[model samples]
Target: MNQNQEIRNQLIKLLEGGIAYQPIEELLKDITADEAGKSISHLPYTIWQLLEHMRITLYDILEFCQNPDYQYLKWPDDYWPKEVAPADQETLDKCIAEIKTGIQTMIKLVQDPANDLFKTFSHGEGQTLMREALLVAEHTAYHTGEVIVLRRLLGTWE
Candidate 1:
């Protein structure tokens, strides 16, 4: 593999998680909508909020990567979920499905040699494909860890 392919591989690994942290897949497994909404009184967010936020933010970054006509999403407000949790099992399942698809989409982006990984977007402020991928990885890992803490508190992680 050339340097770029090597970098792409590394980026894919980062996006997949499970290195020095729990994979989102593992953390998210067995989580129910009810359990996702259960918030510790002192905590500002529930697990569902975190998962939804991750889905939204990752989608935003993926759009930014490909879309020249991308519009800015209002920060904090647009990035977060209005609902504390999914309304039902189907809703939660859909959220998880979208999250996984977004990850795969990002991986496909990275794997494409036509996309210069280090090339900054013309619409972005010094943001490159690599930077956006890393951002997704970092952001997902941070929130995934929080979910783990929550599950432990809920005594749900098996």
Candidate 2:
């Protein structure tokens, strides 16, 4: 395959949780709201918070990449969930859907040859498509690992 195809595959792999660590699917499966809310000693954020943060940040980056007029949420404040616990099962399902949708969008963007991966966005900051894709992948991987660790601490990891 060509370079763009190769890059697209790698990005998809990151979202699918196949390479580098456990898949988000595997990590998140069967986790109850209570389980997601529990925090180990000294851990600031719960699994719910982490999942919401991941969804928020992924949308922010994806919007920035897609829209020139995109407005970012305030750092730290807007990126994380205000509550440590999940509202309900419906909320959890929504967050997961949004994250998955954002990942699919990013994958399509990366796969499209018409879009210049290296071309920088002409907005507040000079960010390129390639840079943003890699950023989301790295960020997701980091938090996914954190979630795994938190699960182990909570005695929830299988």
Candidate 3:
């Protein structure tokens, strides 16, 4: 395999693994909407909020990577969810589905030989395709770990 392919594989592995510990699926599995909304005394957000934030950020980054005309969200505000928990089970399910879809799309984007991974975007400052991909992967992993910790703190993790 070439260097680009190898990097793509590594990114995929990063997304598939738990953020240095448990798998994302393992952490997320069997988590109910109520459990996701549970909050600690000091923490600012719940698992559901964290998950929504992650989904939104990752989606934005993916759009930035793919769309030159993409407009970013208002800093710190639009990046977070308005609700602490999902309104219904279907919303939570859809959030998870969108996150997974974003990851899959990112994997496909990096895997493609047509895209020059190191080339900077013509319309932007000095951002490359690889930089955005890695940023999304890293950000996702950080929040994924947070979600797991929140679950444990809320006594929802099994």
Candidate 4:
């Protein structure tokens, strides 16, 4: 595999491990369903919301990379979910699936030599595909750490 493919594969492995090793499912398998949501830290975000945020950002970046003409937009200044919580198992599962799909699509695009990795995309921040992928990986890992921390705080970690 080439450099891009190798990096993509490593990123996929990181994501897969991060999602699968969710403390709630792996470590705290004995915890009751009702108590699974409570955390000592009372994180600003529930696991569900964090997943949603990660998914949305990943999708946005991948979309930008795939479509050169895509318009760029800034994230809202004060955007937090005020309604129902998205931390439920179903939402988390869906987000995981969507994130996986987005990653795969991005990897395929990057693997194509016809696609210019150095070509600048209009991310408002003026990011290139290479830079975007690295940023995505870093962002994903950061959130993955949050997920693990939340799980541990909630006593759901294995």
Query: Which is the leading candidate under TM-score?
Result: 1
Per-residue lDDT of model 1, residues 1-158, tens digit only = 78888999999989988776667777788889999999887999999999999899999999999998889999889999989888998888898889989998999999999999999899988999999998988888888888889999998985
What lDDT score is found at residue 80 in candidate 2?
Answer: 90
- The CA-based lDDT of model 1 is what? 0.89
lDDT of 4 by residue, 1-158 (tens): 78766765664554344454542234323333234344345456666556667777888788778776776556552233332254556654665678767766766766676766677765446687777777676777677677667777775665
lDDT of each: 0.89, 0.83, 0.83, 0.61
Cα TM-score of candidate 1:
0.96
> Candidate 1 vs candidate 4: which has greater lDDT?
1
Off by over 4 Å in 3: none
In model 1, residue pairs whose N, Cα or C atoms come closer than 3 Å (at least 3 residues apart or on different chains), thus clashing, are: none
Worst 10 contiguous positions by lDDT, candidate 2:
14-23
Return whichever of 3 and 4 wins on TM-score.
3
In lDDT terms, which candidate is top? 1
Error of 4 at 31 (Å): 12
Backbone steric clashes in candidate 1, count: 0
Worst 10 residues of 1 by lDDT: 18-27
| Residue pair clashes in candidate 3 | none
Model 4, global lDDT? 0.61
Q: Compute each candidate's TM-score over C-alphas.
A: 0.96, 0.92, 0.92, 0.70
